[model samples]
Target: MHPIPRIGPTEAADRPRWSVIVPVHDCAPFLADALTGVLEQLAEDDCEVVVLDDDSTDDPARVVEQVGRDRVRFVVNPGRLGASATFNRGLELARGDLVHLLHGDDMVLPGFYSTMAAALDSTAALAAICRVEDVDIDSAPLYRTRSYRRGTGVWTDALDALAVSNRVRAPGIVVRRSGYELVGGFRTDLPHAADWDMWTRLAAHGRVAFVDEVLARYRRHPGSDTRARVLTGANVRERVAAIGVLAGYLEPRRRPWVTRRALVYATVFAARTSLSLARSGERRAAGVQLAEAARCLVQVPGGPPRISR
Candidate 1:
């Protein structure tokens, strides 16, 4: 199989400069909110919305029909294409200069469009990202990520920062279609952490504009992919692998410190999450997390942080 999800060359039409692609998989309950957020802000002539399903059991098509039937296009994969391919299909189908892969369960806040558009336009950035808030299933805000900058500006340290951390989530980010084409598609191998890998690729290629204000809400629930991976410790394991994939993108001298720093963060995070899960009586999941922590520790420089059983 190819190392990355392939997005072939295609003719570019000169209309609808914005494409809001919502990739769904059994996220019927929250699909409406996502469609609504984009529809409310879009200039109909300049934007198109596509809801692509990864062959989910849930009839999300029905939900899409009720949400914005007139304005949205819906497509379903013949079989599950996983996150990377599902997203690559969105990019392929997009006839827009800017593409936003707003996950079905996520929603953009008011002014999300105007602010992000202006940021990219003024800065000529390859991509633009804003602070994202984590929310519950009910759409109640839990917490927001730290500001990447004091205000809206171009990020100079994006590549370096992304190598050691993945603070930016998909909903809060928009990529220029041209830059994405140059960078290639998401890595199919890193199923759970492919977005992080793609972000590192983007940062490596060009500038990333940042908006300090929180402009998107990322739903964190049991049904979400990250949460599902957490149960089996696949999230941490994939992240460790993703972090390792980033080494090739950095300077030779910087690679060692970046890899070590990222591995330490992953190991500590897994170990701490394991203890928390264990205290909450999730023994099976906790054990899985602890094992992953051990695996990460093997690659981390220096000794592991102290952790109690």
Candidate 2:
């Protein structure tokens, strides 16, 4: 285990060791529950929850007030600053040595705080990520796991290996404050998949520990931005862009494998988009996706790759 660096003044009698940032935007229906889950997971001695209300019109302030203003600091943005910017703002105000980003719709599992902290202490990795279980709008379990291996050794190899699969779920990961700043935090350009992009960048600098146990519940619903991006065909482009960025960071010999994976994933994404459009009775859009898929197949070296189940 590597030595974990402590931050802030030891002289300050009461300071949080970890800062959990929750970026909220009109998530009133689930905001209270999400905040409750976060607060409930932490012992009073471990962390502080900073809720950034990104100009929510749903009266989220009331929920924050109900939760109490002492432990949870509410920062109201002047206008709707989007998720990336809002989260960055919260990171700026964070006082803890480590940081955990929790979405407004997600819930932390029991022992989440203690488990992640222990992982950090034991592995001395830059980030500690646990498995996340997909959940429904009503918070019912969906019985699926998203997990990744602990990244060790050379930073580049760890990053390349993790890049081979998009298994890192954003909410399940906790990062050291210094490491987060080193990566320049999350990029605001890729709004939908910014977390994916950030993870790829973080892997370039230090090791990442992946715990097999599920420590968070990731809610999925019709209104989920993830679902919206996938259904609207935006995720395909974002993923392709992410692959391109990662390819530049990998060695020459590894580029082909990475490119191949990207092509295969892109093909499947196009197929799914076409199916979604067809279901909506938009034959024109479906035809466009089919044409795009055909072009991708032609560019791929050995012809169209078989879509994975």
lDDT of 2: 0.72
In order, candidate lDDTs are 0.88, 0.72
Candidate 1 clashes between residue pairs 3 or more apart in a chain or in different chains: none
Task: Name the best candidate (by TM-score).
Answer: 1
Q: How much does candidate 1 score in TM-score?
A: 0.93
* Per-residue C-alpha lDDT of model 1 across residues 1-309, encoded as one tens digit per residue: 347656665567565789899999888989999999999999889898999999888888888889885899999888998888899888888878888999999999999999999999999999999999999988888998998789999988999899997878889999988877888898788777779888988998899999999999999886666667889988897788788788888989899888888998898899899999999999999999999998998887666655699
lDDT of 2 by residue, 8-64 (tens): 222335667988888888877887787887778776678888888888878777888
TM-score between model 2 and native: 0.83
Best by lDDT: 1
Query: Candidate 2 at 190: error in angstroms?
Result: 1.5
Name the regions of candidate 1 deviating beyond 4 angstroms: 223-225, 302-309
